[model samples]
Target chain A: DQQVKQNSPSLSVQEGRISILNCDYTNSMFDYFLWYKKYPAEGPTFLISISSIKDKNEDGRFTVFLNKSAKHLSLHIVPSQPGDSAVYFCAASARGAGKSTFGDGTTLTVKP
Target chain B: DTAVSQTPKYLVTQMGNDKSIKCEQNLGHDTMYWYKQDSKKFLKIMFSYNNKELIINETVPNRFSPKSPDKAHLNLHINSLELGDSAVYFCASSQPDRDGGYTFGSGTRLTVV
Candidate 1:
């Protein structure tokens, strides 16, 4: 069973525009959600995360919004740059689970 | 310096051959994990070790085993390799699964013909 899902296989955005990636989960027990970005041939790097207690968390130009009721979360990057072009993965974890489950990932191509 | 490192960035072998992949982390994490990403890009957890103790076993086949000689090194051994086993294996470490997102190695691409 896929606990976390990223419906979009790919997304394209022009430079300086906003890029948003979405993820949905079926596990209600998840209390923490995280976002990671991966470049070709490289392992994923942590981006931002949000706790179940908060509806939103922001770091620099990246923001993560969570809706516990809908079991959904999104990552937003404003003023997107070409350097941001890469695959983005959304992962979720629950307390006491001791491991996080990752979504398949979405390829984000930020055009220059 | 690479926080998490794995040996054999690329491995190609014949079916029924046995092989091992090694992993090491220098992030001072007590918990380590192995994840497999298949051709379809599905990431699945295979095993996890905390303080050199086995914690999570995801119902993998018996032919596959994970060993952790210490808190920082975890190795995966596979017997009778199969074509279906071809994929990219990644090693990751975290203070604890819940408190951290995990630091992953570049990955090892394994292919069986």
Candidate 2:
């Protein structure tokens, strides 16, 4: 069974607009959530992360909002660019679990 | 320079053949892990090692084995490769302090026919 779920397989958005990706989890033990952006033929690179203690974390153009009570998290990218057209994966982990559980991934295409 | 590097980026072998993928990390991280991404693009953890010690071993097949020679190196060896073994195998490293921010290799695409 998948502990982390990204129901959306793909999303399209216009450049300079907002793009939101959603993820849900079944495990309450997961306290840390992370997002990674992956290009074809390459490994995933860290995008953003949020801790259960905090509801939101932002870095420049990327922001991650966590709803602990809902066991859900969403990643928001404002003014999305064509370079942002890549697969995004949501992952969750707990302390000492070391390993993370990753969703199937969401492909976001930022149209130009 | 790539922090996590895996050699032989692509491998194509016949079924029942044995193949091995090597991975190394330059960062002085204490933990390393192996993850598999299937055709469906689902990423799953296979194994994890810390200081050359086996830490987390997922519900993987016995044909797959992970060996860590040093803290910076982890290798995956698969025997009797099956058709379903065709997938992208990723090697990753994470510092214990960063929670779970992992540095991943470019990934080795293995195709078993």
Candidate 3:
């Protein structure tokens, strides 16, 4: 079963605009949600994360919003730049799980 | 310097052949893992080791085996390779108790013909 899901396979946005990526999860036991960005041939790099206790977390240009009631989370990038074009993957983990389950991933293209 | 590195970036082999992928991490983390990314781009955990001890072993096939000689290295070996086994394998490491994200290697593309 897919515990985490990214409905949008791809997204395109103009540079200097805002880009939003959404993710959903079926497991309510998950308390931690994370987002990772991946280039064409490189492994995924961690971007930002939010704990279940917090509704939102911001890191400079990136922000993550979590809704425990809806079992959903979103990653938002403001003033998106061309360098931000990459695949974004959403993952979740529960306490003592020892590992995180990843979504199928969403490709984001920030046009110049 | 690269934190996590895996060898044999691309491996193309015939069916029934045995192969191995080596991984090493310089971050000095106590936990290491092996994840497989299928054609659908779903990253699934295969095995996890902490301080050279097997911690988590997902329901992977018996043909696949993971070995960790130390805390910083983990290797995967496959016997009787099949076309269905073709995928990109990634190695990652993390501090077992820390909340930070895991560091992943570039990944190895294994193609079984």
Candidate 4:
């Protein structure tokens, strides 16, 4: 079973526009959520994360919003750039689980 | 220096051959994990080790074995590989607390023909 789900396989947005990626999870035991960006032939890098206690976390142009009640989370990149084009993966882990569950990933293309 | 590194970035071998993938982490983290990204782009956990002790072992085939000689090294050995064994395997490390996200290696793509 896929505990984490990124329903959108791909997304496209114009440069300098807003890019939003969505993810949902079926496991309520997950308490921490994270986002990772991956490029071709490279491993995923950490982007942003939010705990179940908080609703939002922001870093520079990237922001993550977590809606615990809906079991949904989203990543928002303001003024998207061409360099932002990559696969974004949503991951979640229960406290002390020692491992995280990852989504299938959503490929984002920011057109310049 | 790379935080997590895996050897043999690409491997192409015939079916029934045995191969080994080596992984090392310089981050000094206590926990390390192996993740396999399949054709569908799903990253699934294969095994996990904490301080050279096995912690999590998913429903993987018995042919696949993970050996952790030390906290910094975790290696995967596959015996009699099948065509379905082809995938990109990633090694990652993180602190036991897990407050921060994991650091992953570039990944090793294995193709069994």
**What does TM-score give for chain A of every model?**
0.99, 0.99, 0.99, 0.99
For residues B74-109, could you state the per-residue lDDT of candidate 1 as single tens digits? 999999999999999999999874555889999999
- State which candidate has the highest lDDT: 4
Candidate 4 wrongly placed segments (more than 4 Å) = none
lDDT of 1 by residue, A1-112 (tens): 9999999999999999999999999999999999989998888888988999999999999999999999999999998999999999999999988888999999999999
Candidate 2 chain B worst ten-residue window by lDDT = B94-103
Provide all candidates' interface root-mean-square deviations. Answer: 1.1, 1.3, 0.7, 0.6
Candidate 1 collision pairs = none
User: Residue-pair clashes per candidate, as listed?
Assistant: 0, 0, 0, 0
DockQ of each: 0.73, 0.76, 0.84, 0.87
RMSD of 3: 0.7
Please give the TM-score that candidate 3 achieves against the real structure: 0.99
Q: Candidate 2 — which residues are off by over 4 angstroms? A: none
Residue range B1-113, candidate 3, lDDT tens digits: 99999998999999999999999999999999999999999999999999999999999999999999999999999999999999999999999763778899999999999
C-alpha lDDT values of all predictions? 0.93, 0.95, 0.95, 0.96
* lDDT per residue (tens digit) for residues B1-113 in model 2: 88999988999999999999999999899999999999999999999998999999999999999999999999999999999999999999998766548999999999998
| Candidate 3, pairs of clashing residues | none
Judged by lDDT relative to the true structure, which candidate is superior, 1 or 4?
Answer: 4
* Runs with alpha carbons beyond 4 Å of true place in candidate 1: none
Worst 10 residues of 2 chain A by lDDT: A91-100
